[model samples]
Target chain A: MILAPQALLSAQQQIQRDLHSCLDYFDLPHPLKDAVHHAVMLGGKRVRPALVYASAQLDGDVMSAAARRAAVAVELIHCYSLTHDDLPCMDNDELRRGQPTCHVAYGEATALLAGDILQSMAFEVLGSRMFDTADLPNPAIALRQMQLLATASSKMVCGQVLDLQAEGQSIDQSHLENIHRNKTGALIQAAIMLGATTVLPVAHPSFTHLRIFGQSLGLAFQVQDDILDITADTEVLGKTAGKDIQVQKSTYPALLGLDAAQVYAQQLHDQALEALQQVTGNTQPLQDVTQFLLHRQS
Target chain B: MILAPQALLSAQQQIQRDLHSCLDYFDLPHPLKDAVHHAVMLGGKRVRPALVYASAQLDGDVMSAAARRAAVAVELIHCYSLTHDDLPCMDNDELRRGQPTCHVAYGEATALLAGDILQSMAFEVLGSRMFDTADLPNPAIALRQMQLLATASSKMVCGQVLDLQAEGQSIDQSHLENIHRNKTGALIQAAIMLGATTVLPVAHPSFTHLRIFGQSLGLAFQVQDDILDITADTEVLGKTAGKDIQVQKSTYPALLGLDAAQVYAQQLHDQALEALQQVTGNTQPLQDVTQFLLHRQS
Candidate 1:
């Protein structure tokens, strides 16, 4: 369940490098650009990017350029969603992953714009010169990956809307699952799928199984997030704990209770592993990732 | 300048078919899907798509599919922006293209989800089976086209954010241009570029000239929009007129006065025609489209 030392270090380095490139090309108007720069500097696990890089390398050494481009693209989508979700109109949270939220740090309007710019920049990155360097074999496959990213992004945004709406409502299991699926699961699935798509021509056989792995892992990831929201301290979790309950936002733990949520997460982990089993070659990195999803405390 | 009888009719029919296919595949939650359908059905010129169809036809007649796809995709991005812009945290408007706004017709949350879903669906349409039909010679080129679409969509979203920020602020000419370029011109450019890419394999010595024609026209088109915002009435324009002034939004008219805005638009229009002059054969459609852009009341 733990991140192996080498895997963890490599993921972190990839995240840092990709994040740097993400902010490198944008030409935002004054303070807005600076604000976004600050947000990126504010630490995040870069777990999504890590999953991409690690999974891409699981079979053997893959091209860094291809893996990194996909990693950055997924993370950009992830980061942009975080920027919007923290907006006053949505989550209205003052803090995120430890630091003040984008809106909190630089007014709601700028934060909203920051997120918008980031989202646009992500696609630009995917479509830009860097992608060309990846020698993506097929421009069409890259475009398809971009489409997948967009779909995942929309799901996340929709999830935010639904989560906000569910705030005072007594939602059932189906509704909660919908919220998480859109919010957390979609991108996670996208991150994995994007990585697979990068090598889709070569790794064509593994696509479906990889997608199923992503979906299962994504569900497990959200359940873990819910558990952390309640069980982890603010310092360990970085953001305010129990904020989900305070805002009356729906969460797996909130609906299923801690014990049941844990069971559900375990089930997803099992399913994710099962899906992983279908793919040939080394799966240790994916296994590590799934374990981390189920067992991470924060 | 008017849509040549045959050209105009075919463009309309093509767009209608594309929209039908787009909606057929999308699965929005019941009420939200209905709301989007309503918003989309409420009319606008379908100007963006028409431009693609016109530009594509200039090269050859084999772009029916590309024109339709680009048309639907641009419309979706436009609709999503309108929905989000109407949210309480943003422009807080109540009407659009002549009907009650998406948020006004649907609850704000559902409207938001509808918009989000529509954006995702746009990318999906580009990547979906509809576009993938018959399997082209180069799927990679098709992917590149989709990537171009995503890039444009991202720019539009960023431009929306910029527009939101520019309200109640004093912006210079360049800033206003930047906003419009990203907001409107980016997608317009994409529409034209995509049409060319689609037809390139079928029609050699392609429509690179058509794309240049489009970029110039697209910029001219936005400048015209600025002029219309001040000169046109709410009844004619559909949305609230002079709300640009009301909200202190940055516009060419706002920055340079009405006379100057008109001059800018006309100059851009003339320049657009100059660009079109490079194309040797059948400039009639191109010329007509250029003049229509400047002279149109709405």
Candidate 2:
């Protein structure tokens, strides 16, 4: 389940470079451009981008420009969601990745606009000629990718709305699952689906399998995140640890016991890996990603 | 230049029906769904949708599903922007289209989510099967339309950022143009371009002419808006009046005297009409729309 450390590092670097290049494409003004860069280039796991790369690797070793664009697009969305989620109206977290959140560094209004522009740019990258290669850009694939990203993004926003509404309320397990499923799982699933669409036909069996795997992995990632929020410190988490508790937000650990949450996360991780059995091609990267998510400290 | 009153009314009704049907496609819960419907359906002229239908009529009389979807998509983005702009963090407007704003009806969080989801839905409609007609759905066309919308939307957001930054500051004429170009002009241009793409090739001479026409019309539209903000009352405007001066946001009337601003608007209006000479279509709708924007009170 473990990835080769050097290979993973190189993939991560490629994603980082591609993402920075994507940002360079925009003709934005000063503080706004800087704010976008800070939100995107700052330290983080780049898990969504990595997922895009890994899933595309399932189809071939040599990644296409479309795959790279898909990777960057998903990451941009992830970055935008984080920026907005940390806004004063939302999570209101002062720190993220051990640094000042977007709103703190660039004023609240700038941060809001930055997040918005990033979302627009993500779709722009997906649909633009910039992503076309020797094979010529497949408009159908691009359209599908745009659709997937938009659906996931809308679902993610819906999750945020639900999460905000659920604050200070005693929600049940199913309600909690619904929130995380839309909030975190939707985008994660989209990242995997987007990668697969780049290389596979829409009707391919692998598409369904990858979606299932992504769903399980997405939920597992959220469960582990909740666990880490309770177990890890501020320095280790690189965010405001115990902030969830401070805000009295619902969490897997809060509903299920800490031990049960851990067990559920493991169960979901196994479910994700099991779904991969139905998928073809090199699934090792997918397995490694799932394992990484399961063991991640932050 | 006036459109047949019945024809325009029917086009407006069609756009309204399509928009409602598009919203019905989502499986969102109670208040969230209700909030989105309220933001979209409650009020406002369907000017953008009319432009789409009008532009499409140039190619043929029978409007395709793609054209209809494009029409709804532009309106969705417009609705989303207005909702977000009216947020507490932004303009904090209490009314829109003679009705209470989205945030005033729903809470701020719901309003924010409503705006975010509406944006996502706009892209979703463009890329959805709903847009696919007998032509097998040109993915290239869909992708191009998406790129056009995304680019315009991002520019609009950047304009908002610039406008916010310019508030309370002494900005020059070029600066004011930059702000309006991004904020209002971009989407208006996008609405025109999107409609043209549905019927014309990317490299077509008409496309260029339509773009030029859209640009001049967009600027003229904003200039007229600024004029109306000063001259019209709240009820007549369907929103707060003289609020621009209250916010100290620079306007055409502020920079130039009222007479001069009116003259400038007329010049731009003429410029818009001039650009249409290079285009070939049933351009009566475009001409009528320009006239409506120039004379609109609300």
* DockQ of every predicted complex: 0.43, 0.76
**Cα-lDDT of candidate 2:** 0.87
For A74-129, candidate 2 gives per-residue lDDT tens digits of: 88899988998898877888999999999999988788778888888999988776
CA shift at B223, candidate 1, in angstroms? 2.6
Q: Show the lowest summed lDDT stretch of 10 residues, model 2 chain A.
A: A1-10
Q: All predictions: root-mean-square deviation over Cα?
A: 3.2, 2.2
TM (B chain), model 1: 0.89
lDDT for A254 in candidate 1 is: 74
What TM-score would chain B receive for each of the candidates shown?
0.89, 0.95
Write candidate 1's Cα lDDT for B151-223 as tens digits: 7876776677677767788888888788888888888888766765665563444355665666677778987
lDDT tens digits, residue span B1-298, model 2: 3344555677889998998889888888667988999999985778888878878777777888878888999999999999989988889999998899998999787887788888889998898867454554568878888988999989999899889889999988889998998899999988888888878877888988888888888888899899999999998788999999999999999999899999999999999899987899778777877777787766
C-alpha root-mean-square deviation, candidate 2: 2.2
Residue B51 error, candidate 1, Å: 1.1
